[model samples]
Target chain A: MSMFWIHFKKEMLEAARSYKWIWVPAVFLLLGVMQPVMMYYLPDILMMSGDIPPEAAALITVPPPEEILASTLSQFSTIGLLVLVLSAMNTVAGERSNGTAELVLPRISSVLPMMIAKWAAMMSLLILSFVLGYAGSAYYTSQLIGTLEWGPMLGAGAFYIAWLAWIVTLVLPLGAVLRGPAAAFIALGSAAALTMLASLLPSHLQWSPGRLSAIATECLTGGDPSAWAPAVSAVCFMALSTIAATLLLKRRPLLPQA
Target chain B: MMEPVLRIHNLTKHMGSLTPVKGISFNLERGSCTALLGPNGAGKTTTLRMLAGLLSPSQGEIRYGNSGETGADNQRWQKRIGYLPQYPKFYGWMSGLEYLIFSAKLSGLPGKQAKLRSLEVLEMVGLQEAANRRISGYSGGMKQRLGIAQALVHEPEMILLDEPVSALDPIGRREVMDLLDRLRGEVTILFSTHVLHDAEEVCDRMVLMVDGRIAEQGELSELRAKYRQPLLLLEVEPGEREADWLRSLPERHFIEEAEIRNRAARLVVQDMDEARAALVREMADAGIRFQRIEAGASSLEDMFMKVVGA
Candidate 1:
């Protein structure tokens, strides 16, 4: 096996030992399932409150299955993204501070492969958690609400995953320089700021990866958002950050400043 | 004649305001255990870090290979060396065997071979019994032995250890020292320590550093002969007569330097016979009660103190 695989496997083992693999996916699955379940029960809940008028009950109709799934994407944008940032905050920063990087970095020689392995390991967890949660949300939406097409659902999930990946990749470069919580906070803050800026002037900033969430919503709700631009931008952002993170790690491979 | 496995030329590191190693150069002969001896803050750790590529030198080149040939850049040559920092921290979640295997694999050993070598080294470091236990549960000495095992797992040509036994208790120190003694001729070992005795215990050569400078470096036998000096130690009864005599001992032409305390003195003498005779004569004339008097040669500890104090 290549050195990358070796490091990647070690990461996976650590995730397993720390229960990140289990808890992260479980959190997302609950979030995804909660969205559709609440949508179906909101009208009944309003009626049972007794302070609500009959007219309010009639106005409260359940949203479509696609809309429920899209709303689930919004749920992910808040809690899901927070969970991801928290879980991955220490991937590099903790290694350095805990002094494990001092032991491992010297043996590897080049920092690039180690950085890439870290990215790949985090990606595996991210992809697994998102897919499992999206599937849970989709299953409930189809059963409780209405029929949905698989093609649009997959496309929507794909675009949103790319957006999530942009934020995830941002953590690495930041973690290479800063402490864990600081890196996580900055990454999530930048992601939120970028999303707001992109939405404020959609036509001017449509190329930003931040627009991916809205594009995912559009795809699910049966509107065609622009293609190839945001996708290419996400790839470029990841490439640049990986190189920058690798260089940062090489410059200060040890914690406590050696 | 055999060439050195590593040649360090002008290895220097400047950490902001202070320089740790100042253009120090030396050659590490193949299969020789050398100690980078220094006190705290003398830049021993910094030199080791630069050698391990954990820190980049401000100005210097670490040519890692034989005397007549320089093999590769830092990145390529890193595989030929293993390193253990002062306090090596392993993944607390990983078992001893798992951590060693991870290190071996990262050094480019294949899966099966990495496993075999990891197990082999675990046994070598006396960690085979605890190979399956988490590193968090290990005692201080066990952790250090595991650190050595990780450095040796890949079978690197040379191992660089920074203060390997300084952080350990006496038993742990002995364990590591014994292990190092067993490894002396098998690999080229360069380790740093503030304790001269630790260096003398296992190392054949010494590189003494003082204030980031190479104060002295040479083979053990050569240094012992070159720095050989005779000394006289005397302990007299506490009295005014003895005190007055000890005060005047430094003025004697035969005594080079005299360090007088309450009722005792350590004199570095030009001629042991002449100084001993003069001291006995002065004591009898002064009517001082002498407890014990001994003539001896100064050890390397004196050399260390004198060089560093200079």
Candidate 2:
């Protein structure tokens, strides 16, 4: 446990020094605010472009706060998830390639503590960025569109974070075996494929972690979707990936392979 | 005799099709400094990596300490070791001081002791002024110094350094060599280097490796005395007759081996006095216009070339 803290502190320090702490949250905040603001001005934006008749523009109704917030979760699913994965993609791969692992791995008996610490640090970042982005979206939606209940908003945010967390966690295992950019690309690609599969066969894939996103959106729009199966599966996926990463790293601690 | 601090029994590593370290075994005494000497691709790095516990051996075992502990008890034993890779890399975002402290802490030092040891190693490596600066901006020499500092910060019982000073400038090399000299009695140091001079400067024992095998290993003086032979270096005025005479000298009864260039020949002889007398008399008879002839004992460099070249 003490060893975990030592490695965790190092990971946090690296994140801070690299400005990952700042830029990742900033990108999330930008994505969060853009959703509600853009939806509020869609009618005027169309009229100004002169692409739609005034009658057609008037027919465009601003989405409710719940719907706007749900769309913000979608934005998080795409760009926000990308930013988080990009920030995390190098966590293990960079250390291995740059030869830092050669220096550190021998000091500790097992790689499990270090892997756990890294995962915790990444989780801390993901949680911090998600909370800020989702809060900003809720605040903007309340002021520009309509009022929202804190109960559903917080619950929906939790579900969305779970969805993002599992996908981003894939980078850890992938990064153990591949380069940083390749890990990030495959992580995002897997998330897309899983989501597509879940939608294509919802009855068969109800427990897919990909369903958390849709469940989050449903929770926001006042629909009570069953969140247990997807949330539990997301946690399982994260845990399994973290273990897989640890095992892979232990097998080849200095993986600078091209 | 006390048990060796570390022992290896036929350690081997097969990475894909290339077997870098092929069934090599050696033991390290508790406080002695040994140099792992080898030419490039001699598996020095691979051997050091296995000893450092970074790479698991494909076969055989590495036993540590007086108890002859093996991999099952690695964590406790690993704390007693400090390793520096050939190209030691740190988090570039970290300052030299921070990296040292981190290393010390990871080695199981208490927080306060870790800080004090960090500062001590920083001063020892002469990185006190640049301790706060990011490592990304450090020069190669400074980084090398930091590598040494981190290796010593924990005050481990043994240190495994892979090519510790191979990348340094002359002055940096001198400083590191001096540091290793100072560290000799205090800690068990096993450093690998192809340069025989560096090993000769500080190490008492030498393990010469070639092609993933131990070509020769023993006390430095013992190996020197064993391989030492009477050598004759003859440099003559450039001429076809002189070159022919130099070539012909190797076929003499007293000469064991001959390396001939256009105007120079290095002759290893079976008997120094007989070879010298016969060569001089032959030169006088043939009227060979030789510029210089010197008889001396062969150096370790010659043995290194012989081991590595073969």
Candidate 3:
């Protein structure tokens, strides 16, 4: 168990030293800061136009900066998803390609600990990025539109982001078990295919990890916390996927001689 | 008797239709350095990897003799085994010290202990000066040394090094061999190499593999004694026609090929003493002035070829 923490700490250090933490959140911040500001000013700029037609003027609703900021926060939070995918791309694929996995595996006995440690480290980074993005937009919203209700919803939404981070963590074991980027793509693509399949099913079959994105959106819109059942299902998929990946890895050579 | 540290029974591996290693079995005693010697394409690497637990044999099992009965727990046994592959890469972003520390941590050491062990191992591999440097800046030899350092950091009871010195230059090879020499009393090492001199330098006993089987295996001195062949070559004065006269000697069996090579004559004899006695008398009687007559030392390469038939 201590070994897991040591590996996790080292992984976190590596991520920090590589400045991955800075760049992932910075990209999201750019999106976050822009989303609300864009929403707030675009209507005002259009209203100032002498060419504004009478019929189209009715469609323009100049929301306060807080509403604009909230809408912007939602759009930019999608960037958090991109950060998770980018991080996963490097987590398993880069290590296997560089032969670091071979150097690591023989030292450690079980694939479970190694994969679990790595997953935790990556999830920590993903959650950190999401919180930073939300906080950046929240600060802007406060300065521009004064205080508002539903500040607690931001915390719940951050937890939702964390649960999704755990879902991506499931990719590491599959990456380690299978060789190369093709395996990474196939594993992630399988999850995407599952999501698509669930979308096609009737509402009865819709309660799965596949609906996490929609569940996340609902949580952001001040929906009941109980609506997070689908995201909770995603956690179950994470556990099952991690276990399956470990077993699959045990069957194949984690490190073939160069 | 102290049980063998490692025991293998009928280990086999096949690549498609071709069997690379077929039912080869061997045992190693504690603190013994055994070299797995073979020509390229022989199953030496495959067998070493199986012992390292990096490769699974298609048939048969390898048991690391622990306290429990056979097939009880592999994880406990694996913890005691260390493996250094032929080509190992570190996390490029990591400093050499960080890489070693990470390896130690993976081997179940806690934070403080892992760092301490990593420092000791880096010093052991003569990389302490460069420990803070990124792994990407390290040369091939430095990377090789780091691989050794990482493998030994956990203080494993047994270590498998595949072609450890194969990438080193002559001086680097000597340094690595000297290091291995020092590790004699500390750990049981199973080193695999195609380089004959490396095996000759550090290995007490060796298994020469050929076509997925043990062609020969024993103490170095024993192999030397068993395959001893006494042959003498003498170079005579030019224009003396020593080849014809030497061939006519009663007790000497002449090598016509050596004789034809510029006033040189070769003699093959079972017993060196008897042949020398006969050659000296015949040379004096025939007034043959030869420059050299010396005993030939058989090399491991020669022994390998003779055992494996060319």
Please compute DockQ, using alpha carbons, for every candidate against the native two-chain complex: 0.86, 0.86, 0.51
Candidate 2 overall Cα lDDT vs. reference?
0.90
Which residue pairs clash within candidate 3? none
| lDDT, candidate 2, A57-163, per-residue tens | 88898978999999988898888888899999999988877778889988887788999999999999999999998889889999998899988888898898899
Query: Candidate 1 residues B23-130, lDDT tens each?
Result: 899899888999999888899888888888788888977877744445456466788798998989999999999999899988888889999999999988888999
The digit string of per-residue lDDT tens for model 3 on A88-144 reads 666765666667666777766677876677777877777777677667776666665
TM per prediction: 0.97, 0.97, 0.85
Go through the candidates in order and give the C-alpha RMSD of each one to the true structure: 1.5, 1.7, 4.2
Candidate 3 second chain TM: 0.89
lDDT of 1 by residue, A1-258 (tens): 376777788889999999999999999999999999999999999899899889778999998899999999999999999999899999999998888888998887678877888899898999999999999999999989888998999999999899999899999999989999999999999999999999899888878898999999999999987867988899899889889999998888775553
- Per-residue lDDT over B26-126 for candidate 3, one digit per residue giving the tens place of the 0 to 100 score: 88888889999988878987887777766678998787874454654666677777889888888878899998888887777777998999999899989
Residues B139-158, candidate 2: write the lDDT tens digits. 99999999999888888989
Query: Native contacts recovered, in order, as a fraction for each?
Result: 0.89, 0.89, 0.68
Lowest lDDT sum, 10 consecutive residues, model 3 chain B, at B251-260
